[model samples]
Every structure is written in C-alpha cells, then in structure tokens.
Target: MRWFWKWYLWSEDWKVEGSFPYHLKKMVIIVAPHTHWKDFILGVAVRSAYRFTYVKFLGKQELFKPPFGFIFRWLGGTPVDRRNNNNLVEAVVQKFNDSESLVIALSPEGTRKKVEKLRTGFYHIARQAGVPIMMVGFDFKNHKVIFDEPFMTTENEAADFERITNFYRPIEGKIPEQGLMHF
Candidate 1:
C-alpha cells in the first residue's frame, strides 16, 4: 500500500500547504472547484500521498447498488439520500460523535456544473461537530494539490467562507464549466 502511494499515486509536482494538526481528532475537509469527474481520481492520488487514513465521504444512494456499492463502501463511502429533508449537518455531527477520528471530505461546489455560490454544508457540518475545516485545493496549472490552513468556524460564517474561497480564487481559471452556464 505504502509502496504504491509513495511511487505511483502522487505526481512529482504535487505539494501540500497546511499541516494536518494533531489536535484535531474529527473534522470536515472540503475539496473545491469540482469541475470534472477526473477530480475524483486526483483525490485518491492526493490521499495516498498524504497517507491520509481518516477520510469518508457521501455519494448518492443509487450508487449503493451491486458490486460497485461494495467497492465504494470499502473505499470509505457513505450513501446519502439527497431527497431527505433532514439536515445533513446534524447527521454528520452525529457521525463525528460516534467515531474517535472521523474526517469527512466534501466538494463545496457540490457538482461538476458551475454555480454562483459554493454549498455551505461543509461549514455547517464542521460547526456542528465543533471541528476545524481542512481546505484542500487541486490546482490544474501545475497539477498540484494544495492544502490550505485548516480552520475552526467562529461566529462569522460569511467571513470564514470568503477566507476559504480566496485561496482558490487565483487558480479559478482551472475550473471547468458545464454547457449550462446560466445556472
């Protein structure tokens, strides 16, 4: 496992920014500018390089079918019923409470399609769980993965979001767009 991670997983140009603090036992990690399906592949490479062991993420419940579902579960995926009106943040918080070291990664962009605003679920989940947010960025310019300063949400949600978004702003050109631009 470590052999593949050290050699084949990460690209030579890859770099990480902020350190994953030891104090943070449970938290939310957000992957941004989710413009392509390829981002998912890059995520695995990044995780393997960092030797990140505490990652788990959500996918649509439909993906929880047959052989692929088993593979997804083994790879740390949780099935989410997107139609449910119940707050996902509360559910994520409960998961944090249940595990000693839970690290959930979410794409703020939510979909491959472009959007005017990033989803706020990552913030809400971290805030509710009383854990810091680890902001990870994949810059296509040099094909590098940058890890920003992991932060804990305070009273100001808007400001905190801006701070997080600013890091990705410079490399926003790498963001791919779907045909539907008006939305």
Candidate 2:
C-alpha cells in the first residue's frame, strides 16, 4: 500500500515536504485548508508515504455504517458522533492516556468550507493530552504537502492561533476561495 501510494503521488505530481517525528509516538496532527474531499486522499497518501501506520482520523458516525464501514476502519478511521453533547476532547485525551502511542489527525476548520476562524478543539486536545501538535499544510497550488515543526500548546490561545494562522497563510487549498478566510 505504501509503494502504491508513493507511485500514485508521483503520478499525480504531488510531493511531501519535511519529516515525520518518530520519537513522539502520541501527538495531534492538524491539517488545514481542507476545502475539498481530495484532501482526505492526499492525507492518506502522505501518511503511507511517510510510513505512519499509527495515524488515525475521525469521521462522522454515519460514515461508520453500511458496507463501507469496514473500509473506513481499515483506513484508520474512528467514528465520531458530532451531533450529541459528547465530551470529545476528554474522551480523546483519555484514549491518548490509555494507549502507548497514538496519532490522531483533525481539521481545525471542522468542514470543507470557508471559515472565519479555526475550531480550537485540536489545540485543546493536544494540551489536555500533553502532546505536541503537528501542523500540516496541503498546498494544492504548489502540489506539496508541507509539514511544520511540532508545536507545544500554550495557555495564550490568541497568540498560539496567530502563529497557526501565519503558518497556513501561504498554503492554497483545492478550493482556494473556500479555504480559511481569516484567523
């Protein structure tokens, strides 16, 4: 599968930048400029290309049903119920505490549409889990998947979010207009 994805990325003229930190077995990975479904495909390909087998991503609970459910699970998808009053951050923090190693990826925008500000769940999750946040930029315009140095969350949310916004300012998504509009 890794080789297949490598070939696919090559054929599609896509390339991954930077390296995945192997020392930290557990961390939060946040991908930005998620304006299209193709972002998911690119994410899976990049993970395989980087040989990151422990990476898991959350999908809507609805996606966990039907015949395709098994496929999503095989792809490291974890069912997330977004409708209820679930304490997702605490639950995920508990999961991190229970497991020796776990890398969960989430989109701060929380949707494939333009947003004025990013959701802060990923930041809180990293802080609560005592793990660093891996920021990944999917720059479709450059056909590059860029990875930034892992960042440790601070108590000041405004400043931390400013840093995140600055890092992702240059990256262009598939639907540039529908990408993040502001911090």
Candidate 3:
C-alpha cells in the first residue's frame, strides 16, 4: 500500500511539503478547503505514503452505513453524527483522553460547499484535549499537500482563526468556487 501510494502520488504529480511532526503523541490535525470528495482519497494516499496508521479521520454517519462502512472503518475512519444537539466536541475530546497516542484529522470547513468562515469544532477540540493543532492544506492549484508545524492552542481564538485563514488562503481546493475564496 505504501509503495502504491508512492507511485500514485508520483503519477498524479502530487508533492507533499513540510516535515511531518512524527513525535507528537497526540494532535488535532485540520485539513482545509475540503471542496470535493477526492480530498479524502488524496488524504488516504498521503497517510499510507507516510505510514500514518495512528491518525484517524471522521466521516459522516451516512458514509459509515451500508456495506461501505466497513471499508471506511478499515481506513481509520470514525463515524461522526454531525446532526444537531450532539456533543461532538466532548465526544472527540474523550477519544483523545482515552487513547495513549492519537491524531485526529478534521476538516475545518465541515462541508463540501463554500463557507463564510471555518467551523470552530476543530479548534475547541484541540484546546479542550490539550493537543497541538496541525494544519494541512490541499493545494489543488499547485498539487501540493502542505503540512504545517503543530502548535498548541492559545486563549485568543480570533487570532488563531486568523492565522489558520492566512495559511489556507493561498491554497485552492478541487472546486475553487466551493472553497474559501482568496482575498
């Protein structure tokens, strides 16, 4: 699988940027500009290429149903019921506390459609779990999977979001119209 991903990434001309922080025992990774489903496949290839078996990703409850659910689970995906009134952050935080070493990657945009601003769940989850936040950008325009250095959350959320925005601003998603438009 790792060799396959290495070939796939090379065949697709995708370049992974930055040194992955492999030493972190736990982290909340945020992947930005998720404007298409292909991002998930790209993520899988990259994960395999990097041998990131400890990292887990969340998928909608719908994706976790039927015969396909098992496949997702096998790929380290957890079913997330993102419906109203669910204490999702608390639940995710608990997963961190329960695990000795875990890395959960979440999409800050939370949807495939265009969003005015990022959803704050990823930030709050990292803050509450006492884990560092690692930002990853899928730059479709440049065909790059860029990883940022992990940093712990701070008290000022607005500032943190500003920093996140700046990091993803230049990266184009699969569907440029549905992703965060650059200012």
Candidate 4:
C-alpha cells in the first residue's frame, strides 16, 4: 500500500517538503489550507507514502456508520460525537497520555469552508499533551506537501497564533478563495 500510494502521489506530481521528525513519538499534526474535500485523499496519500499509518484522526460519528463505516476506521479514523458536548480536547489528551506513542492529524480549518481563524483544538491538544505541533501545508498551487518544523506550545497563544497564521497565509489551497486568507 505504501508503494502504491507513493507511486500514486508521484504520478500526480505531488512532492513533500521538509523532513519528517520521526524522533518525536507524539504530535498534533495540523494540515491546513483544507479548502476542498479532496484534501483528505492527499493526506492519506502522504501518510501512506511515508508509511505513517499509526497517525490517526477524528471524524463525525455519522461517517462511521452503515456501509462506509469500516473504511474510515481502516484509515485510522476515530468517530467523534459532534452533537454531544464532549470534552474532546481532554479525551484526546488522555489518549495521548495512555499511549506510549500517538500521532493525530487534524485540519486547522475544521471544515472545507473558509474561516477567519484556525481552530484552537490542535493547539490545546498539543499543549496539554506535552506534544509538539507539526504544521503540514497542502499547497495545491505548488503541488507539494510542506512540513514546518515542530514546536511546542508556549504561554503566549496570541503570538503563537500570529506565527501560525503567517506561515499559512501564502499557501494556496485547492480552492484558493476558501483557504485561510486571513487570521
């Protein structure tokens, strides 16, 4: 499967930038410029190409039901009950604490729609779990997956957010207009 995905992405002319920080046993990966549904496919492609199948993600409960439910699970998705007022951050942190090593990738936009700000869940997850936050930019314009250096969250969230937003401001999403254009 890794070979297949590598060939698939290579055939598509997609490239990855930066080095994967394998030394970090746990991390909260924020894949941004998530302006289209196809971003998920690219993510899986990169994950498979790198043979990083241990990386997991959370999806709505609805996606884990019926005929297609098993597919998400096969892709390392954990169903999340979005309708309920679940303390998701703490739960995810608990998962990280319980496990010796765990890596979860989440979209900062939280949806395919355009947004004024990046979601803080990833930040909180990384901070509370004592894990670094790794930024993955799906630059559709450049046809590459750019990985930024991993950094641990600090006491200054506003300044950290400013740095995060600036890092993504120039990247182009599949839908340029719907990408993170502003902080």
- Which candidate ranks first by TM-score, i.e. highest? 3
Each model's lDDT: 0.73, 0.89, 0.90, 0.90
C-alpha displacement of 131 in model 1, angstroms?
0.5
- In model 4, the worst 10-residue window by lDDT is 78-87
Q: Write the per-residue lDDT of candidate 1 for residues 1-183, one digit (tens) a residue.
A: 556655654445556556655466787888876777767767776676677755887766777899678977877888777677677778888988888888888787777777788778778888888899888777766566777778889899878977876876655425545312222
lDDT of 4 by residue, 9-99 (tens): 9899999999788888999999989988889899999998987888998877888998999999999999877667689999999999999
Query: Is 1 or 3 the stronger prediction by TM-score?
Result: 3
Predicted candidate 2 versus true structure: per-residue lDDT over 97-123, tens digit per residue:
999999999888888879888988889
Which parts of model 1 are misplaced by more than 4 Å?
A: 9-13, 172-175, 178-183
Error of 1 at 127 (Å): 0.8
Clashes of 4: 0
Model 2 lDDT, residue 26, Cα: 90
Give the local distance difference test score of model 3.
Answer: 0.90
lDDT score, residue 171, model 1?
51
Total clashes for model 3: 0
Q: Write the per-residue lDDT of candidate 3 for residues 1-183, one digit (tens) a residue.
A: 899999999999999899789999899999978999999989999999998877999878888898899999988899887787599999989989999999999899888889888888999999999999999999999999999999888999888888899898888999998877663
Q: What TM-score number comes out for model 1?
A: 0.85
Worst 10 residues of 3 by lDDT: 174-183
RMSD of each: 3.1, 1.2, 1.0, 1.1
Clash pairs for candidate 4: none
